[model samples]
Target chain A: MALTNHPSETPNLSFLKEKALQLRRLMLVQAAGKGQGYLGQGLGLAEFLATLYHYELRYDRDNPEWEDRDRFFLSTGHYSIALWAVLADIGYVSKESLPTYGADESPLEMSTIEGRVPGVEMTGGSLGHGLGIAVGAALGYRLSKRDARVFVEVSDGELQEGSTWEAATAANAFGLDNLVAFVDCNGIQADGAMVVPIEPVADKWRAFGWDVIEIDGNALDQVVGAMHWARMARGRPKVVVMRTKPGKGIARLEAREKAHFIRVGADEWDVIAKELEAENA
Target chain B: MLKGRTLGMGELERIEDRPFRTAPFAAGTLAAATRCDRLAVLTADLGKYTDVHPFRDAHPDRFFNVGMAEQALVSVAAGLAKTGWTAYCTTYGAFATRRAHDFLAIACAHGGAAVKMFAGNPGLTTGYGGTHQAIEDLALMRAIPDVTVIDPCDATEMQQIAEQAIDIPGTVYCRLLRGNVPVVLDPATYRFEVGKATRFGEGGDVGFVSTGFMTERCLDAARKLETQGVRASVLHVGTIKPFDAAAVAEFAGSVTRLVTAENHVLVGGLTSLVLDAMQEAQILRPMLKIGIPDRFIECGSVPYLQDKYGLTAARVHERVAAWLDRSGTSAAA
Candidate 1:
C-alpha cells in the first residue's frame, strides 16, 4: 500500500526479488502439506506476479472493489496457488487464510476468486473463460474513460480453448489498448509439451493483431520491461509470452517432468526448507 | 389489463418512437434506478435482434459486440460483473440457452456474478424457423439457481423489465421476443413485478395459466370459452423461475381444471414451473399441458408449427372443451 515516486522511480528490484522468493516459499509450504497444488505454476510464475503486484498493478489492499482500480484476471484458474502467495505477501489477504489453501470451507480454494483476497478478481478455473471477462472489464474502463487497465494471465496449453481465440480476436478488433494478456509459456501441461512442436508464439499473437512482446519470465528485469512496453503500446491490446521453467525455485522439482504436482517425503521437505533458507541467505 | 395492440410484422418500426419497448431499458428511464454505472451491455452480433441497439447507440463506450461467439458472450459478461460492472449480455434464446447454458450456469450463476442475459425469440415468436426459436430456453434456464427467468408479454413489458434488470443486483435470464407481440397487459393497470403473477381474466369452471407469448392466446381461449358457457380464468405467469407458486396454486385449487400452455418443450418450462408450484402447494388438480411435445421441432414458418403444435386459439378451445366434457363439469356451482 506504500507509494514511492509513482511505480517506476528507483525500481525496487531487490524488494521484488525478495517477494518472489517469499511467494515460492509459501507455495512450497502449501504444496508440502497438501502433496499438491499448482505449485509448479506458482513457482514458475512467481517473478511475473511479483513484478506486477509490486510495481505495475494499481490496486488497493483494503478495498478490492474500489471502482477505479486496475483489473487483473487469472484465465488459468489452476495457478491460484501462485496468485494466492503473491496476494498474501502483498497484505491483500489475512495470513490466517493461508494454511486453509485447499480446505472445503476456506474461501482460499485451490482455484477460485471469491473476492475474499483483496485485488483477486473473477471466479475462474475453467480454461478459455477468463480472457473474455478481462476484455469485458477493459471495455468497461475504456467506456467510462477510466485509467484502470485489465491484465489477464493465461497458460500456453490453455490456448487450445476456442473461447480464448474468440476473445483475443475481439480484443484486437476493438483496439483495446488498456488490456494486457500474459501467456505463461512454461512448456508443460497435464499431458505433455505445448503444441507438439516449437510454436512461433509471439508471431502468432502479432498475426492476431496484438502488440506482442516476449521475455524470460524468470528474469525480473525482462518481465518488468515487457510490462512497461505493454503500457506504452497504444491503440491495440498487448500480449507478453513469458518463457519460464515449470518449477523455477526448487532444483529437484524443476528437473522432474511431473513436477506439475510435487510430493516430497518429510525428509525431502526438510531439504526443500533448507534450500529455501539458502535462497533467503 | 393488456388489451388490443396491433400484432404481426412492422412491430419494431411501429414502436421505435414509443418509449419503454424493452424492460431493462425502461428501468433506466426512471431516476430511481440503481447508480451502478457498472451498467454495460454486451451483445453477440445481436445488437438489434435483442433490441439492445438503442442502449449501444446511446452509450457507445458502454456497449460491446463480441461477434458471433455466444459462449464467450456470456463468459465475458460474467467477468465484467465480477469486476463490479453490471453487464447485460444479449443473444438469441436458442444460442443463449443451448450454446451458452454451461457458461450461464457456472460462470455467471454459480460464480455468484451479477449479470443479466437477454434473449430474443423465446418460444415461437421468431418466424425464422427452428434454429431461431427458443422452444426449450425456459426448460434449460429454469434449472439454474439464483437465475431469475422472465418472458415479457410484449415490447412494453420488455422495456419495463429490461430497466429493472439493470437496477437488480442478481442474474436474470429473460426472453426477448422482438417486434410486436399481442400487447395484452397495460403497463399502467397491471404491475410487472419480477416474481408476481398477472391475472388476465376471471372465470370459475376452468383456468388457463400460461407464460410468454401464449398469454395472449389464452385470453382468446377465455373469450371462446365464454360463448360456450364455460367461464375460464386466465393467469399470465411472466416470470417462470422463482415462480409465483401461491397465485398458481390458489387458482389451480379453486378452478375445476387447469390448463398450462407455451411454445416450448413440455419439460423444464412454464408447464413444469406451474406443476412444481402445484406440488409445493399440495394441490392435486387435473391439469392439461399444451406445448411442443418431446421432439426436435422441424424448421418452418412460425404459423406452420403453431398449427402443427396446436398452439392456436381454436385448438386451445377444443382441448379445453374436450377436457371439460370428459369431466362433465359446469361452473353453475
Candidate 2:
C-alpha cells in the first residue's frame, strides 16, 4: 500500500470511470470518422486503456520519448483506435486530426509504426512481439538503474503464437518483475470464435512462473485492483488475464454476431455515438 | 566418471597456408566493448558455438543467454536496442533468418534498431544439412532495407568487422567465421571498410569477385591460373548489401571477363550484386558464376560437400580454365 506511484495516489475511482466513458466516446468518433474499424475490440479495451493512461502509466506528457517513462505497448496493432482515442484524450495527439485515421498518407495507420506516432513504445500488430519487447525494456530499466516499469496489452488469441510462449519463458527466466502483461481474453479472433483453443489460460501462465491476476476487464474497479496487485508483486513478472466483452459499451454493437470488427454504415455513426453518450449519461 | 562425446560442430574446416586466430570475434568484440560504454552480447543457447563465452566470462553482467528461442533472441535484442543499448546477437544462420525473420524484419529492420546479428554457418559451411545451413542468407538479409550485410574473408576481416560494425548505424548481419579462422587477408595491407571491395593479384584476364571464406578459394584459384600463363585478379567483397557497386563495375571494366563466387546460391548472392553493379555502371562483361546451385544440399562432410558443389579452389580453377578455353580468350590475346 505504501508504493507511491500514480496508481495508489490517484485512487479516485470516479475520475477513471469518466476517463473510460470518454475513451469510448473518442473511440466511436475515430471509428465513425473512417466509417468502419476494429471498433468492437477498441470499445472493449476502453476501460483498460483508460486505467493505464490515466492512472497506472507514468510518462511526461510533453515528451513521449522520455528515457525513464513507463511504457504501454499495445500488442495488437489493429487496436490503434483505442490508442489513438486515449492518447488524443491525454493531449499527446491532437484531437482535430482524429478524422485522418486509416486515411491515405496518415500517421495514424490502422497498425502502429513506432516513430510515426508518439507515446507508442513499439510498433505492434504482429502478434507475439510485445512481451519480449517489454521484457527487454524492463531489463534496460534495470541496466540503466531506473524504476520505470513496462506495461503491455496482449489478446487471448495472441497466445496461439509460439513466439509469445518463447517470450513468456524468457520473461520468467530473466525474472523481469518490472514487466506486467495484460491479456485481453475477448473470446473471438479474425477467423471467428478463437479457432485455436487457449483454455485454462491462467493455469498456463501460472505454470510459466508468473503471478496471475484474473479480472472482469470491463469492470474498472477490478482493473484498478489488478494494477495495484501487479504493482505490489515482487521477484516475478505478472499477467492479468482480463476477461473482456467485445463492443461492451453499446448494446447494438455488442448484440452483433461479428464483434471482432464493427463495420457500421455511415448513417449509423450518429446513432452509435448517441448511444455511447446515453449509456454513460 | 563421465563419458566424453564429440559435439556436432558446424563448419570447422579451415584454409591452409595462413596464420590462424582463435576466437577472433571474441577478441575483436572485447576490444570494441572497451571503447563503448553500453555494449551487450546476447545468444540463444548457442553460446558455445558462437564463441561469445569469452565475452560472457569477461563481462558477465553484459551477457545474456535467452534459451533456444530464436524469435525471442532477435526480438529481445531489438527491444534492448530501442532502449539505447547496442545489442550483439549470435545464432545459427538458419534459425536467425528462417525462424526469426519476422521479428528481425518488423522489430529490427522497420524500427532501425542498432542490433548486430553475427550469423554462424552461412550458406554451405555447415555439415548439418538444410535444417542447420543458411543457404540463402545473403539474399534474404540483403533484401531487408537499411540493414548492412557483410561476409568477411578470414580472421583478419572478421576481427576488423567486429570492431567496426559496432559503430555502424541501424542493423547489421555478418557471416561469422570463427574457431581458429584462417588468416587469408593481411591486416597491414587489407583494411575492412563498409561497402568497399579490395582487389588482389596482378592478372587482368579473369576477374574473380568473391565473398566469405570463398575469397580464399578465389585467391588460390588465381594463383593456380597464374602458373598457366593466364593472369587472374581476385576481388574480395566483404560487405554485400551496401555493396561496393563502383568497385565491382571498375573491376569488371579492367578485366576481360568475370567469375563471381560465394559460398551461397548464385541466384541472389554475390552474382546478383555484380550483375546489378555492372548494369548500373553500364559495363557489359561475360560473367561465370561458381557457387552452389538452386536446390536443397545433402548431408555430408565439409570437404565432400565443397568438392561436390564446385566450391573448392581446384574446382573453381578447373571451371575458369574451361570457360576461358571455350571463349577462345587467353593471356596472349
Candidate 3:
C-alpha cells in the first residue's frame, strides 16, 4: 500500500530531534513515577519511536485499528515507556494517563499488552514473538491485497531466541517486502551485559535473506533515512540494526553499571527533570 | 489411473478396514473454506499428515506451511486472527501443546483470537515414543482460559467438530484422530454440541464415561457388559473444557457405580475431570479409572499400547466388572 501521508515536504530534522528529546523526557518522567522500569531501552528507543510516529508511519491518531494503517509492533515489550511517550505525544493516548503507568489496574502496563490498549498492536515482553506476528500481519495484508505495512521493533538480546531466526527465515521465504524489523542493539539484557555474543548481527540477517541496514539509532537523520530506504526496498523483508546508547540525553543514567532496569530516587527525579528542562531551553 | 499400479482386491479390502479419520477433517475444512473467505489454514510442515492438504489444495492463497517452527505456526496464526481472519493451524499433538503452548496462551487465548488448532496423533495413536505422544495435552490446554478443548471420538464426530469449531469464538485445541480412524458414532441421530455429553446407551449398574477414541471403546465395552448380564451406560464427553457437569452428574446419579476411560493419563484428564465434577455435584460413587497410568508410554504399535495402557474395550469391561465386584454393586445389574 502506498503511504497515506508520506512526508512529501522535506522532513524538518531539527523538529524531529526536539520531538525525540521530548519523548525521552516523558519516558524518564513515567519511569520516575513508577520508581523503576525498563528505562534504558525506553530512552534508547525514543528517537526511532518519535521519528516513526511523527514523520514516517502512516496512522490515524483517532483510528488506531484502521485497516490500512501501518502497524508498529513493539517486539521489545519492556520498552512500553518509550511507546507510551510517543502515543501520548501523538495524542493517541491522553497525556494525563502517563503517570498511571505500571500501576495496578492501569492500561499503561510496564509491558505492552495489545487489545487492552489502543495503538498497541500486540502483547510483548516475551521476546522473539513480535517479528513472527509481523510476518503474519504482512502476509495477511498481502492476501487481502491491502498495502498496509508491518514494522516490528526487536531488541539485540531477543536475537538469542531460535524463534526469531525462524521468523527471519519465513519472512524471507514469503518475500514479505512490506515487513520491516528494527533491532534495538542497546547492548544489555536482564542478566547484565549480554553473556552470549551475537556480533556481526547484520551478517546474520543478511545471511537469512533480509535486507539489512545498520545505523546509529540515536541519530534522527539516519533513523529517518533508513526508514525511507526500507519502504522502497522490494521483494525482501527489511531490518535496521539500531546501535543506540543505553541512556541517551541523561549523564547519570547513562553512566550506571546496570542499565537494563533502572530505579531512581524521588530527589534524583527532580534533579533529572531540571536537567532536562535546561537542555530543552 | 494405471491398472498395474492400482491396489489389488485384497489390499483394497484391507484399506476399507482402516478408515482414514483425517479425511473428514480435510473435507470439513474444505467445506468451511468455501463458505468463509476469511478462513485460513496454516501448518508447521504437517499439512499432509494432519489432512490440511485438502484445504491447501482447494485454497492455495489462504494456506501457509510454516516449515516446522511450531511457535511461529501458533503466533503467526494469532497474527492472522488479529486481522479479523479465522485461522486453523495443524501440527502434531505433542509439538502443538508442548512446544507452542505459551504462544497459544498469550497470543491467541488471552486476546480471544479466532484460531482453531487441530492436533494430530493424540496420545498412543503414534508409536514414535514419548517425544511424539501427547498424553498431557488435555491438562495443559485445559489450564488455559478461553480455549475450547475437544477430543472427538471418531471420524464422523471429527468432521462435525471441525465444522463446529470454526463458529466457536475464541481459540480451540482439538485432539485429532488422524489416519485410519474408526467409525463408532452414527451421524444420523448424533449431533455434536460444544460442551454437551452424548449418551449412547442406557443401563443402571455402571456409568462408563469416556472421551476421545476411548469413548468408542466404552461403547463397545458397554455392549460386551450387556452380554455378561452387567448393565452399563455409555456417555461420551467430547468437549473437555466447559465440561458437561450436569450430564455427568445425571449419569452418575442414575448408576450404582462409575468408570472413566480415556487414552490420556488418568491424572488431570477425563478421569480427573469426571471425579472433580462428581465431587462438586456431591454424586459420590465407587469410581475405577481405565487409562494410561502416571508414567511415560513405551514406543509400540497402537494395539500393543492400547493393551499395555488398559485402553482396549475388553480392558474397560474387565476393570468395570472388577470394580462392580469390589464395590458390591455386581448384583445391581
Candidate 4:
C-alpha cells in the first residue's frame, strides 16, 4: 500500500567495510573477557549487521522505541554477540556493557531478550519464532498505514525448526512484501554440522511463495543492493539467503574445524586482535 | 439456568426449549473489538469451529485467518502486539497449549505481549477425543510466568472476559465456552475480576471452590446437598493464575469442609491451587477434589464422559455425601 521503491544514492562502501571491521573487533573484545562464546557466528555476521545498523535500518538512537520506525528482529539470539556490538556502536546500548556480555545478570544476554534491551524487538534463542512475529508486525504496520519495514535475521541451523516453515507459509499467504527475512547461512550448528539437511535454502523460500535472493553475505555492496531490491513492495514476502563463512574476517578462526562456539586461549586474545586488524588494513 | 438449541458434546441433562446465548465467544469478542480500535481478531483456521465467526464477519479488516498453524498463530499474535495491536486469537485449547507451548512461552508470555488467546473446548467440553480435549490447558497456561489464565463459567462471564482480558496486563489465556452457552451468572450483578472469586450463597456447611463451566455442575450439586441438610456454597475461581488464594483461604476458614471441582485433571489444576491456598493459610480442613483422572479421555457425549469421569452434578453430589459420611462430620443445613 505504501510503495516507495526508488533506489537511493550509493552508500559509502568503504565506511560500511570499516564498520564491519570495528564490529569484529568489538566482538573479540566481548568474547575475550569470557574466553568462550558464539564468536564464529558473530564474526561471520559483522558485515551483514554492520550494513544493516549503520545504513539500512531507519531507526532513531535517541528514540529507540519510536513506534513507526523500521524494526530489526534477531531470530538467532546466540548472535547477541553481534547484536550487542552493533547496538553499542549505534549508541542504543553502552559500549561499557560489552565486557559483561554472557555474564550473569547482564542486559546483553548470550541470547536476545526483548525487555532487556530497547532495540531488541523480540526475545530470540529458542529458534523458529522471529519470522512469524515479524509477519504479525508487518501486518499490523500495513493495517495502520505505516511504511516502516520489518527486517528479521535468522540462521541456516534455525531453518530445521518446523515453526519456521509455518511462519514462512503465513507470511506468503498474507502477501507481506513489507517483511524481509535474512537467512544467515553459516553452515554450522551446535552439534558440529547441520543435524538436518536444509539445502536449496533459496528454492525452499521460493516454494513458500517468497521473493528470493541469494548472495555472498560478507560482500557489503551485495548486502546493500539486495536490501535495495527488497524495498520494492512486490506483493510477496522476501528472503535473502546469505552464504557466509563461519569466521569471515580472520584466517585462523575461519579455518577452524568446528566453529559453532569459539573459545580462545587466554594468551591468544592479542594475536586474534592483530589478525583482524592486519587483515582489514 | 438451562440452555436450548444445543448440539454435540455440549448437551446437558436439563436441556429445554428456552432462550440461550449462542456463540457467546463470538458475540463477546465482536462487541469488545467494536469498542477497542486497536483490537485484531485472528484464528488458526478454526474460525467457525472456535466460534470466532462473529468477530470475523463484523470486523473483516481486523480479522486474519492464519490457516491451521498454531505455532504461527501465537507468534504472529505476539508480533502483532509488538507493532501496537491487541491480537485476540482463538484455536482449540489442545493445540494452543500442546502444539504452541514454546511459542506462547518465549515469544508471547516472555515479552508480555498483548496477545489474548481464547481456547475453545476447555477441559472435557469436546467429544473430539484426546487430541481436541484440552483437559490440562489451565494448568499448562498457569505455569507460564506473567500469564493471566481465565476460565469463564458461562455466557455472561465469557462476554465479560472478552471485554476485560484486553485490559489485563501482559498476555491472557482464557478457556472459552462457545456455542449455545448457558448463562449462569447475572450480568447485572456479576463482574469478571481477575485474581478474584465469586461466592454463590453463604452456606457454612461445605464450600466448593470451582472454576470453568464446572461451577454450573457444582451449583446443581449444592442444591441437591441442600435437600439432604448440607448447606453448600460455591466459590467460582475464574482466574487460575494470579489465583484468588485469599478467597480460597477465607472460604475454607468459614466452611466445615472444602470441595475443589473442575473439568480438568487433579494435578496442577483448580484442585491443586485450592490445596496450595489452604495450605498457605495453615488451615488443615478436610477437602475433596472432584475432577478427571490422569489419562487421555476417549470420545463420547458430554453426559457420558461427565458420568464416566465423575464430573456430573449427580456424581459430585454422591462423592460429597460419601466424603461427609466417611469423615463422620455432621453436614447440617
Across residues A1-281, which tens digit of lDDT does each residue of candidate 4 receive? 22121234678899889999999988998999788899999999988888888777887777887887898899999889999999899887888889998999899888899887878888998999999999999999998989999999989999998999999999998999999999999999989888888899999999999999999999998999988888888899999999998889999999998899998899999999999999988
Report DockQ per prediction, comma-separated: 0.51, 0.73, 0.70, 0.85
Per-residue lDDT of candidate 3, residues A4-28 (tens digit): 4444447778888889888988887
What is candidate 1's TM-score against the reference?
0.91
True contacts kept of each: 0.53, 0.60, 0.50, 0.82
Off by over 4 Å in 3: A1-9, B1-22, B331-333
CAPRI quality level assigned to candidate 2 from its DockQ score? medium
Question: What is candidate 1's lDDT per residue for B1-333, written digit by digit as tens?
Answer: 123332221123222332434334434423222455668788899776565666666667677888899877888788777656788887888989888887888778876677888787666654566677778888788889878989776655666676677665578898775544445567677667888888866787788889876776788888888887888889988898778999999888878789998878898888888888888988877889999888766655555556678887777777878878878864221
Q: 3 or 4: which has the higher DockQ?
A: 4
TM-score of chain A of 4: 0.96
lDDT for A183 in candidate 4 is: 98
**lDDT (Cα, tens digit) per residue for candidate 4, span B1-333:** 123323254323344543457777777777787678889998999887778777777778889999989999999999999989999999989999999999989999999999999988877776768988899988898998989999888889998888876788889999877778888888789988899998998887888999988898899889888888888899999999899999989999999889999989888999999888888999988788898899999977766677889888788888898888888855443
lDDT of 2 by residue, A1-281 (tens): 21223555557789889999998888888888888888899889988998888788888777777787887888899999999999899887998888888889988888888888788778897998988888788877777788988898899999998988998998899888999999999999998999988999999999999999899999999998988888864789999999999998999998888988778899988898888888888
**TM-scores, each model vs. reference:** 0.91, 0.96, 0.95, 0.96
In model 2, the runs with Cα more than 4 Å from the true position are: A1-5, B1-8, B330-333
lDDT score, candidate 4, position A68: 76
Q: For residues B186-222, what per-residue lDDT tens digits would candidate 2 score against the true structure? A: 8798789899899897578899999998899899888
Backbone N/Cα/C clashes per model: 18, 1, 2, 0
Q: Best lDDT goes to which candidate?
A: 4
Candidate 2 chain B, poorest ten consecutive residues by summed lDDT: B1-10
Position B76, candidate 2: lDDT: 85
